[model samples]
Target: MIDLHVHTAISDSSLSISEVVRLAKDKGISHLAITDHDTTKGLQEAIKVGYEIGINIVPGIEISAYDYQRDKRAHILGLYIEPGHPSLNMLCAPLVQRRKQASYEMFRKIKAAGYDISWVDVQKYEGGTGVYKQHIMHALLDKGYCGSIYDDLYKRLFQRGNTPKTQGIAYIQLEYIDARAAILAVREAGGIAILAHPGQLNNYDAIDEWVELGLGGIEVFHPSHQEDDRQKSMLYAQKHKLVITGGSDFHGFYGDKPIELGCHELGEECIDELLQRIKR
Candidate 1:
């Protein structure tokens, strides 16, 4: 099976790249993409490990972008990308720094709220590029504030609201790269740019606009996508001649919910379409 979407500890995933790759190999996944969020810090190591273990590792990334006009999140996934390409680093490096800053601010709020968490506590759990909200939650979970990462407490503390006072106390708005720039950067980095999980973020309305910006594919299968969503994405792909792909979006224990590796299948035809477009 091929899992076109995945994350490792290089981002928010709880498992390291080697562990993720080994697990996928055990589950019979032949092709696995390490599309960690905004960073390609360990793709070369993962590629090396996957090569030795007989799994094809696709160097990829998921950019946290936004549709400014529609005012919604529109993440872009670059498949078969050249890890550390200048375009990607230029577009995403600031995003990583911004997120790290926001997370520290959130940590401050959480600590002020009487949570017994500390920076060292959070850092020890963080396996890669900067501190994620999940890292903070890991600390809180240990302090008995929450049972799981995405539980009610997580929503109450982190979910976005209309205004500052109304928003989650720990929530801070992040500056995301424009969706157009995200697609263009991915293309400049020599990969096919795919609109990721449009259903989850209601980004359907922006697909036509993004396709014009060189959005080359759509994620028809994702943990967040329902049957109707799958059909809609497939229809969109047909209408636009976009490559169709899917994956587990696995983040190990840091996932929003439980899911398995290689649970979603991307047929060879669809996989071949992406492979043919890959310039890296």
Candidate 2:
């Protein structure tokens, strides 16, 4: 299988480059892409390991963007990007900063709510890389302030906690570029942009609108997507002439799921079509 969308430690993923590559090889993945969120830092080591293990590692990144006009959020996955592209790097910088600021604010809120958590404690969970909400959640759990390592972040940290008077707050506002802007940026940088995990978005109407925005592909295969959702995504892709992609979204040993690289299958035809589209 050619799994085009996986995460390494660069994102909220727990898997390191070596472990991801090792798992991919074991899973018989002929082609793999480590599309970590907002950063290409893991691409070098992942590429090196892919060379040693005979897997084709496509350089990719998952960028978060929002359509304020339509009041929607979208994730654009750029595949086969030029790693040294200055424009692409410039585009991702603000996103990283926004995420960091939001994380720190969230941490302060938790601490103010009488939780034995601090910004330093949350930073410690970063593993020197992707500083996402998952890291903050894990940090709180580690400090015995929360119940489990895989706590419901949206509920506990974002909403269900105490009021802002007793807690610091950080709401995820629309950041950087919108979906259309991200797609255009990737196109300018000589890369194909795909909608990553549309099922998770839970807004097919919005996706249909996105397909009209020059989105290059759709991620039809993802662990979180049910069979019915997968089928729906495939139909959408076929109807829109969008390239189809898939991945395990592996975050290493994050709970019960193993970091089985190509655990989610993508058809050979899907890979072929994607390549053809990129060539054009």
Go through the candidates in order and give the C-alpha RMSD of each one to the true structure.
1.3, 3.2
TM-score leader: 1
RMSD of 1: 1.3
Query: Candidate 1's residue-wise lDDT over 128-221, tens digit each?
Result: 7899999999999998999999998898789888887677779999999998999999999889999999899989888898899899999999
**TM-score of each model, in listed order:** 0.97, 0.86
- Candidate 2 off by > 4 Å: 127-130, 152-154, 160-176, 206-213, 255-259
Q: Who wins the lDDT comparison?
A: 1
Which regions in candidate 1 have their CA more than 4 angstroms from the true location? none
lDDT by residue (tens digit), candidate 2, 1-280: 8778787776777767888888888878888888887777768888899999898888888887776666666788989887757767788888887778777776676677777766777676575444677777777777676675555543545642245553325444436567777887777778888888878876466667766666878888887789999999989888988877887777774533544667345557766776787788
lDDT value, residue 167 of candidate 2: 34
